[model samples]
Target chain A: MSNLSKPIPPAGDQDALEVEIRGKTFRGADGDAVRAIDEIAFSVAPGSFATLIGPSGCGKTTTLRIILGLDREFDGRLKLPAGGGRIAAVFQEPRLLPWRTVEENVRLALSDEDTGRDLDDLFAVLGLAEMRSRYPGELSLGLARRAALARAFAIRPSLLVLDEPFVSLDEQTASRLRTLLTDVWSARPTTALMVTHNLREAVQLSDRIIFLTERPARMRGVYDITTPRADRDARWREATLPALAKRYSGVL
Target chain B: MAPDHRADATDTALLQRPAALGRPVFGPRLVTALSLAGLLALWWIAAIVADSRVLPAPPAVAEAFWRDAATGELFFHLAMTLMRVIAAFVLAMAIGSVIGIVLGMNREANRFFDPWLILFLNIPALVVIVLAYIWFGLNEAAAIGAIAVNKIPNVVVTMREGARTLDRDLEEMASVYRFSAGRTLRHVVLPQLQPYFAAASRTGISLIWKIALVVELLGRSNGVGFQINLYFQLFDVAAILAYTLAFVAVMLTIEFLLVQPFEAHSTRWRPRRAGS
Candidate 1:
């Protein structure tokens, strides 16, 4: 169902993000042409949580980069309809400016119109209120991730992109951050497209999951979780995830 | 299970007890004082053994210093040298940083200018000073210009490296946020380059001052360098030593009072050393 070449007519829908990568090629160190992405097409619906799941080095990050407009050399199109909404991203690494305080780092994301808008509430939601004056280097890894999340959400972004924001963290910290993500996300719902390899994490956080194959990635399948987010708690995930994994066993 | 906090506290106390007992009796200031006194004693012994006019004793140098101070000659020359140093240092840093950033950002420009930079870097300080005096006709402008030119290449080299090593991740973050050019340069680019700026300034100050003396000796009518030149002709070793010592002390004072504090403040966000 997700293989359509054209976007779902983006004229009136300002909140949806449409991405189509016909091909993305770059020359490698050995001067050989390497195709990083091959004919992947997806659209994020308004205010929905979508995740792209794949193995490591599967061009997930490259896809995210293209969608975020960081890498414009790709032979593709990323269409965000003309509107008031902006784009924000949480990269794999917490890319906070080490020299600035947490407050400064977050404020750097704020556009002119967003300036002077009170952030105390947002900070409180992310547990970053007391951390406002501290530098990124002084913060623990978990705190740094939270700060990155805060920076992304600070802009009230219409389309949010996340690149494995919880990878490399301990299980406990990652779970807590996942919960914190949902809390912040629900407070002000936006169209979120996240990239993750962990299937359970995808199941826990996403409304739709788009699976991708290995390097030179192609879409494997797109799955939608019908259960309401509030109902998909520990017991539900435990009961449903094994069968779900089995269903996608070939792709996994 | 977590380790017992009470037991951990007791262990920490036991570990710290020996450190407290083994702490040195002499403080840093006292140690510095003793070292300087030992050096002075050694100098006095060397003077007695040599007993020559060339290697003047500590007392002789001090007497020369006092004589110059009482005559107001010391203040005038010191002030002259200080002014030249400040002017040249600022000029070099401003010109070098702009050029360095430009070259670093544009690969084509860097390729074009790389040979020019190397040429300037290798040109001896003496030659630059001589050329400046000859072409510009031995004025204050020439003297300051020569000193600044002598130091600009070093600043450019350091700042270029700093610009090249800037964190691309942070830069991408800035762009994704749609930061204005001014905002990105100030908040993202400049902070990353502060350490490099600090290094350039430290080296620039030392290099510029030395070149400034040469510039002064070649052309200027009044500075520590000129005074040293005047004493050189008379074979007055004591006078030359006095002037050199006074200028060195002032530079050292500036380093301690200004440069070190600025460096420390800029990197205040970095993880501090243990016990600092």
Candidate 2:
């Protein structure tokens, strides 16, 4: 089956996450202590998409890192579901190997369960089919971003984490990529956590949006979206943007 | 660099590369031939002006090269030196990379061994050669050992920097993808270190070439260095130049044919700058 069509859940259930952050602190390089996150707790039920929106540098990326088990030096209880499913991430940067061609980069993410059949379709879906043989250095930032997405999705991830995946992109490309992301995402039943600065992106794609406070982040609110992500058209976002903009005017 | 995409590396398959540089049919060899001829012309003129046998003319050196090569002594010594060089290069690279990777990967290890690395880096190559001979006596093993020992610290420094500068984002991507250790090393780690490896190898060959000669000259009875020592005692400047020129020609061949091509291949993914 094309991983582009729909990803098979490692567990019958799409992944569930229960996160609790009491006090996460770290010592900086100069030995000064800083509190990054504080009492920012939230959860995503199986097969739901959630976005963490906060002021820049309010530890949203750090929170994603904590969930992915990349950072352990924190006081937190991040309880992911039991079944061993693949976890995939698209970091803020493309982070692709300059030497490895796009195909090889995607191949590195394949697991035992992955049949390696969806590569072509995945590339085609992400607008990277023709450029699969090119190295990362040979790619533009937009194309590189698509390759990163292809690599993440190639593994048939149960837990999809995107950390500012569309930052620094022009609006046209970002819109196209976001649409591409939502189409690919909605095709499969997977739990996704995204750290984004875009309010419209959160409103359109997320089933729930968790608003976080300033540094040493604490959740201000978590709003459940009634509109189906697939059905969220331009009208829905047009109507939704101003209201949310006014609502988060003080925090954002 | 880019206007000639087809001429350089285009959509060529990387692994099954037939040629290392993918260089176009150009005058690269011709340029080199011209430069060598120029050097020989200048040397011939200088020899004529000096009118001294101490700096023998090109023909005199070529005759010496022919005589030694005909006697088979040149081949034997060259073979011996080549073996020691290859053996030492491999040994130093292996041991130095291991130590370097360890120090780079672990903070505790770096803290413990950094001072030692600095100390060895500052030590003279001559000091290492004499000490190795003193410790192990004048044998082939001691000669090879001295060259490798002198080489290890530099390789370690280079590899350590390579390991340290490894991209953390890529590592996180590897972990998030759950890449196996073997696969990660092959794909994610090794490619990042290619430039550093090239740096180490380029510097290594030049350094090892000089050191191995000294090691041979000091104690060993075979190889280019020992042969040069014998020619020096006889004041046979022609013989010395012949052996030296042969060694130099071989080194230059290795540099152009092997090192230059390998470097080009390693960094092929990098985008070209404007013009040549």
Candidate 3:
């Protein structure tokens, strides 16, 4: 069991987000009360990458939804950064409007003031420059996911939430996209909290990994990967993953 | 193998075969021309055989059409009927789409109004027209109102189904991005409902035009329907057929030039099928 201590941020960055969820319950179709999240309390330091790791049926996504304000039924308090920072998310599915072109879909996410950001650079980074006029139905799953990522980052969101964005893709495509995700995040790093089940991905992409127990999930443990992102090469991952896996064997 | 029929065919004859797989030898345009010509030939044959006052020959009908066009009476009646169609169609589509979206989104309202929708749907157009005339007294407003009333329930039924099937995921995305209500409706909601709007309009045009004629026949005096009625009373079958064909031609033109092209444009994002 992890204690409820807010992590210290680096100098000059103090507006870390604190999420405290006492309980979350859902009523099944049969009208029985089912607890989805027993309790989850964690703080994501500003500019830090945090990944929520848990089993499939565990309530990782439920917690993410609550924090994103998509579901308000849970008992929780999410203290966003001062000045009410903007939040954006990439859902499990791409969720792009099928009728609109890719450019339009991304443009819809931007507020009027967001026009100052150079969308062309974002498109170039995601390799979606030529795909701006295409419809979502015309793209493959991987390309559609790339478009979804572009929409999320186009807003320059302060809190970027990703809900299993790269799930179900082939290994090659998924790996390529992970590299792109890190590149975009580094270009304009924000406080990001991603929900994924892949432990290796968590090790590669996150500064901190929050482990949760299975259904009616609770924070089981927290691991800090102090290794800088650039040095987490294949050889480093080969050595570090098994040690972390053995330490948090139950949650992993 | 059977003899290669393509080797002997002319270039123009071979034009239709390779462009579309599994299509008939004749192109669609050519088939449409043939079908219309066939109907004309059948009518000509029937006129020759009967040689009666009711069954006029092709030339007689054509002469009546030309006479009406020459006097500009055809244009007058045709314009009057077209105005009514446009007015009633716009009114019914506007009011019905709003009501349908509201009902579809609200369970309580839908339940309360379900019986009313059923009643309106079951009521015959004639009864509505008669009631409107009796209450409002025979006039353009009453006539157009009655036509719209008959068509509103149909648009409501279609738009309600459309609203019910809107994608929830996309809606959530819109809200999460803080899109304004107007923006959400324009980009997220309207695109999803377009096919249903097209469906309602296609059926609305056909249904409203038929009811418009009835309204004119019962009360109004300036439309093509009135002309047909007057010809019927005088036992001038050729004149009646001429007016009927003229109005039908206009409706067909609207269907092709407006309704169908809009439908194709709306669904252009979908993958193409073999024939469509």
Candidate 4:
């Protein structure tokens, strides 16, 4: 939901490694072959939270996929930091194994060697201990998303990528999840990138917001969120976030 | 609001503690048993009134059953038939499951064998049995082989379709997590394939029995079908009806006790939908 069109001036500050995507484009299905994403570049710092906001069909999800190595056909050099640590993703859908229990789904993300943490504590953090044995089909949308969050965090990821992970939840549920996410992020600060069109959510959770253009999406803007993460409450809608929303609504 | 209510109800239902004493002894099952007894009494009355040899009285059939049982003829034939069916079923399942998984996993293998499967499925059971007898001779091996061959294609088709529809996301997740192949097969793939295995077992059991009977009648020297053929030669309608009823009873017991229970157990983990 962070829609703004202010160009990010290249600052001298260089605490984090930058992900530079040059001439990145994808071919569409029709013989006409329209570009879905065009040369999008951005940098996310270690332990910093960033959100990508764009109109529907603006290649926000596509950009995330390029980084995840899921879309190798796209043109460009998608550089990651040397000695790239494990990257965990929460897809737009929960994508939980329908046959598996909630705990089993979380356990699926853990490697055999990484066994320092107790699963119960992880489930407790997400308020999902009682629902551990339940299958995905049995869970409500909010609980399913919580389970997904638990699964991603259980990996102890160095980078967490989420694609509209809470879009289907009710406002109250989404707010609760946002608080849980921030708490989890605070506990073990990892570089986080979330894609969402919800401007309030972007401003509430992210350190910076990256906005993209309409269909052949390129970076339309980047806004350094001045709101301190500790002061932000997911329940309250901010007046300034809507101003950014209004600006990008026209450009997108 | 309705979806919220439904979800809350499911959560509550799942939270409820299981009964400590298990299910009560007296229930609808007892009522159903009584109703079945009542039906049998009515049938007995009708048979007495009709005084027909073709539709032999229940007591007369019972007497025939007793006579066969007393002579050990019933056990011998039943055991023989059951052994052949069991052997054929196990072989069919083992071969069918392997072939099915292969076909399911590889598109090229599926395409290669699909026409052959269709060809076998379409062929008459009688022709297949006769061909087996001609090729292998009128023996136990020939009879069992015929039944096994007839059953394999159906099992293969069921298992192949089951394998084809497996959740790709789960497979990818398994690979991402670096789950051992054995663990993935045991916990993930096998559980997903349960319904298909159940379907195959159900269909396979029914088909194998029917085909086994035909094989016994045409090629084998012993078993229920051979005995029925012998009774037909002697014009013993009572014996025939008794044996037929006995087989039907056996089939029903197998369905309720074996197949249904197995199916239910395998699918117990699948979450029930609201209003289901």
Backbone Cα, N, C clashes tallied per candidate: 0, 0, 0, 3
Top candidate, metric lDDT: 3
Tens-place lDDT per residue, model 2, A110-197, is 8745635657777888889899999998888889999998988777777788999989999999989999998778665578899998
Evaluating just chain A, the predictions reach TM-scores of 0.91, 0.91, 0.93, 0.86
Look at candidate 2 and tell me the lDDT of residue B168: 91
What fraction of correct interface contacts does each candidate retain? Answer: 0.84, 0.89, 0.59, 0.30
Top-scoring candidate (TM-score) = 3
lDDT agreement of model 2 with the native: 0.85
Better of 2 and 3 by lDDT: 3
- Worst lDDT window (10 residues) for model 4 chain A? A1-10
Candidate 4 Cα errors over 4 Å, as ranges: A1-34, A69-71, A79-85, A113-117, A233-252, B1-53, B101-109, B136-142, B168-184, B272-276
lDDT values, one for every candidate: 0.87, 0.85, 0.87, 0.78
> Candidate 3 residues A1-252, lDDT tens each?
011022323324647778899899999999999899998899888888999999997999998888778899878788875336678889999999898899989988888655455689999999999999999999999999999999998876778899998899999999999999999998878889999999989999999999998889998899988999999999999998889889888544
TM-score for each model: 0.92, 0.90, 0.92, 0.80
In candidate 3, what are the lDDT values of residues B162-244, reduced to their tens digit? 99998988998998888889999999999999989988998999898989999999999889889989989999899889988
**Each candidate's DockQ:** 0.76, 0.71, 0.64, 0.27
**Model 2 C-alpha lDDT per residue in residues B54-146, reported as the tens digit of each score:** 988999999999999999999899888888998999999989988888888899999999999999999998999999989999888889999
lDDT of 1 by residue, B1-276 (tens): 111223334444434466555355665567678998999899899998999999999899999999999999998999999999999999999999989888877899999999999999999999999999999998999999999999999999999998999899989999888899999999999988898898899899988888888888999999999998999999989999999989999998999899877876888899754332
**Among these predicted structures, which one has the highest DockQ?**
1
lDDT of 4 by residue, A121-189 (tens): 778888998999998889998998888888888876666789998897889999899999988877766
In angstroms, how far off is B121's CA in candidate 3?
0.7
How high is the DockQ of candidate 4?
A: 0.27
